[model samples]
Target: MNIRPIEINDYSRWFDLWQAYLAFYTVELSDEVTQKVWERLMNEDDKDLYGLVCEDEDHVIGFTHYFFHGTTWFDSSYCYLEDLFVEQSVRARGAGRALINGVKEQAQTHGAAKLYWHTDKQNETAQGLYNKVADLTDFIRYDIALKP
Candidate 1:
């Protein structure tokens, strides 16, 4: 019911939610890889990444990981919301909204001009919620993963 910035001590709970988020995306990254990502998120030098947790009685039910993106047109940097998820059983209860709005507040704190994120093309539920909070950008995200 409460949303707060993610602390180092909250990793175990955050990990559970993280795994669920990946599963939702049909990803199967190794735990070791995920741990490295956790380290990056907590690094003091990295102000670009901000993580938040949604909790109830010391249990983490959701998370939001956001950061800044360089943009030429705005006075403030663009806020890129990287990840957001709430446990399935708890959907429609506002945890996702809490995490997103918390990201919005953090973006404002960091002097960001706008906040943005991408959902899978088929993710109808999330799109519905997102349209209510922010406008949909016309851009489509494309990725080209590096090959070793």
Candidate 2:
């Protein structure tokens, strides 16, 4: 598997993996939102948002989207691995690990103070991978959805 920064030409395959990712979470996002995300990932001037894709045999099989942000507790920025997905057929072949290592390389390159991500509580399969790659924090996440 080859991991590299995402290119504009990788959109179609990336979208397929993106949709599968959402499906895995049983979530749906608007097309406009998706378009905006793509735009941000592709924007060279946008230093915060970024994306990477993993390919096998010249076919994109997985993708990850991440971003860097300032935090009150840290001087340097933190990298958040926002989204990650691999095609169902290619799940356990180290593609996911390769994608994450790609992001870790980027975060280190950017001098990020920390790298973190979240997964649903019941996602044991993903947790298995996360446990291998990162420390499990005891902190709980809370969210408030604001009305648009």
Candidate 3:
């Protein structure tokens, strides 16, 4: 599998993988949100948000979305990998890891201080891979919904 930055031509395949990714998490997002995300990923002017895709035989098999932001603890920006998904049928084929490594290379290129991501507690399948690729932090995440 080959990993590369997402391009304008990747939308259809990317969308299919994106919907699958959302379904895997049991989350429903509006079309508007999805469109906005696609736009952001495609926008060359948007330096903060970026995307990568893993292709096997000219087909997109996986994708990842990440961003860099300033943190109080670091002098350089921190890279946060927000989403990562690979085709269900192709798990363990290294597409997921390739996409992650692609992101890590980007983070390093941009002088990021660290790279991090979160996974559900019960997602042991994913955690198994995460455990090998990254350090598990003890910090717990909490959120408050602010309605518009």
Candidate 4:
């Protein structure tokens, strides 16, 4: 599998994968949200947000989205892996692992101090794969959304 940065012409194909990812989590994202995300990814001036797609011979089979931000605790920007998804049929074929490793490489290249992400507690399948590639941190996430 080839993992690479998403390109201008890849919008539709990338959206298909994006939809699949949302479905996997049973989340509904508005078209506005979708378009905004695409715009952010397409903007070359935005260094914080980054995206990658995993391709086999014919199609894009997986994708990973991550971003960098400043933190009080670290000198280098932390890379938060916001999203990662491989096609259902392609699971266990190393595309997921490749995507993650690719992100790790990018974090290093971008001078990121760390690369980290979280998964739902119920996602045992993903946890199984994640356990192999990364250490399980003791941190628990708490969200307090200020806006509707």
Best by TM-score: 3
Return whichever of 2 and 4 wins on lDDT.
Answer: 2
- Rank order (by lDDT, best first): 3, 2, 4, 1
When summed lDDT is taken over every stretch of 10 residues in candidate 3, the lowest stretch is: 40-49
Off by over 4 Å in 2: none
Of 1 and 3, the candidate ahead on lDDT is 3
CA displacement after TM-score superposition, residue 63 of candidate 4 (Å): 0.5
Clashes of each: 0, 0, 0, 0
Per-residue lDDT of model 1, residues 71-141, tens digit only: 99987799989999998988998888889989999889889988888899899999989989889888977
lDDT of 2 by residue, 43-116 (tens): 99855689999999999999999999998987899999999999999789999999999999999999999999
Clashes of 1: 0
Candidate 4 lDDT over 1-148, as tens digits, reads 8989988788988899899999989999999999989898889985557899999995889889999888888887899999999989989999999999999999999898999999999999999989999999998888997986
Q: Give the winner by lDDT: 1 or 4.
A: 4
Q: Alpha-carbon error at 103 in model 2, in Å?
A: 0.5
lDDT score for candidate 1 against the true structure: 0.88
Give the CA lDDT, 0 to 100, for residue 74 in model 2.
79
Best by lDDT: 3
Winner on lDDT (3 vs 4):
3
Error in Å for residue 124 of model 4: 0.8
